[model samples]
Target: MTGGSGGIGGAVARRLAADGTAVVIHYSGGAARAEAVVESVTAAGGTAVALPGDIAEPTEMSELFDAAERRFGGIDVVVNTAGIMRLAPLAEMELDAFDRMHRVNVRGTFVVSQLAARRLPPGGALINFSTSVTRLQQPGYGGYAATKGAVEAMTLILARELRGRDVTVNTVAPGPTATPLFVEGKSEEQIAGIAAAAPLERLGTPEDIAEAVAFLAGPGGRWINGQVLFSNGGIA
Candidate 1:
């Protein structure tokens, strides 16, 4: 289940469905947009259902997962791309923003991952989203980086927790993706500058990140457990 139905989450859901996995595409708002994604999947001869929920709320998340069970019968992969990013310096960050960030990015991930790890049929994989800012230490991204850092810290430990079950928990950190989420308040020039920072001399794409996710969700990445795969086009 991913958040913000418009960008990376949409791409991930589509790519996974294309790989022949029955995808349960989760969203909070943007019902129309979510349905559009499902339509595309079905049109392409894949199975998918749009399940909506607030990742920050346990009851909502429960309903979302329940829908997955009702439709697919057995859970194989859980990709968590649901997240929010509100920028502010440490002093300017609001309590609400901090609370919201942790609630969704940290607590929400725990709720989703815990359930998946415990209930996944063998060969299941859990994929969580992180950010390269955790490594770049970009200014004004203090709180955002903290949430991703927490995700990274939990990814490996969860693998150990589920070792006996053969379930794998890992994290993906992308750098400078051209998702609508990143262009919210930036100027075109500012966006270009950030793109230039990557070694590939271009911004990342949702498909690029989704391709990595499909790998983990598929058989080839079965042996890759507890890893933080960075799909950032060589961006530091």
Candidate 2:
């Protein structure tokens, strides 16, 4: 399940569903946006259902996954793209800000991954979202990066722990992308300036990130495990 409907998670859902995988689109808020994602997939001849839940709560996650299984028989692939990002320097960062990022990015990832690793079929795959800031060490991203860093660490260990289960766990780290979150609070020129920072000289599209996710979840990626595949257009 993914969080916050119309960004990277939505793109991931659409791409996977298009590839013939029925997707369970999870949303923390914005029901209409979530429905739009589901509708997009359905219009393209793919099956998808949008459900809302708090990824940090065990009972809520349980119900979410149960509902998914009921709709699609079983979940063969789990994607924890549910997350929140905020901008603040370490010195000025409030405990609540740090906790908020960790709550969704770290705790949420662990909760979904734990369920997938234990209950999914042998060949199932679990993918999580990290960020390129973990590599570049951008100043304001200290708190956010710490949370994703936690996920990256957990993802690798989880892969080894799932040894014989035939489950592959990995994280995808993306650089600055032209998503709502990236564009928010930025002027057109400022957005252009940030986009130009990447070697490719352009901001990433959600589809770019989704394509990477599709590879990791598909049969072709079964042999790949415990690795963070960076798809940041060489930015990091």
Measured by TM-score, the strongest candidate is 2
**Tens digits of lDDT, candidate 2, 148-199:** 9999999999999998888899999998888988899999999888788888
Q: Candidate 2: list runs displaced more than 4 Å.
A: none
lDDT of 2 at 219: 86
Q: What is the lDDT of candidate 1?
A: 0.86
> How does residue 156 of candidate 1 score in lDDT?
82
Each model's C-alpha lDDT?
A: 0.86, 0.89
lDDT of 1 by residue, 1-236 (tens): 66637689889988988888888888877899889989988899988888888787778887778778988787889999988887899999998998899988999888888778777888889999999898899888999899999999998899988867878788999999998778888899999999998878999999999999999988999999998998888877
Report the lDDT of model 1 for residue 172: 92
Q: Estimate each model's TM-score.
A: 0.96, 0.97
Find the 10 residues in a row with the least total lDDT in model 1. 1-10
Question: What shift in Å separates residue 13 of candidate 2 from its native position after superposition?
Answer: 0.8
Clash pairs for candidate 2: none
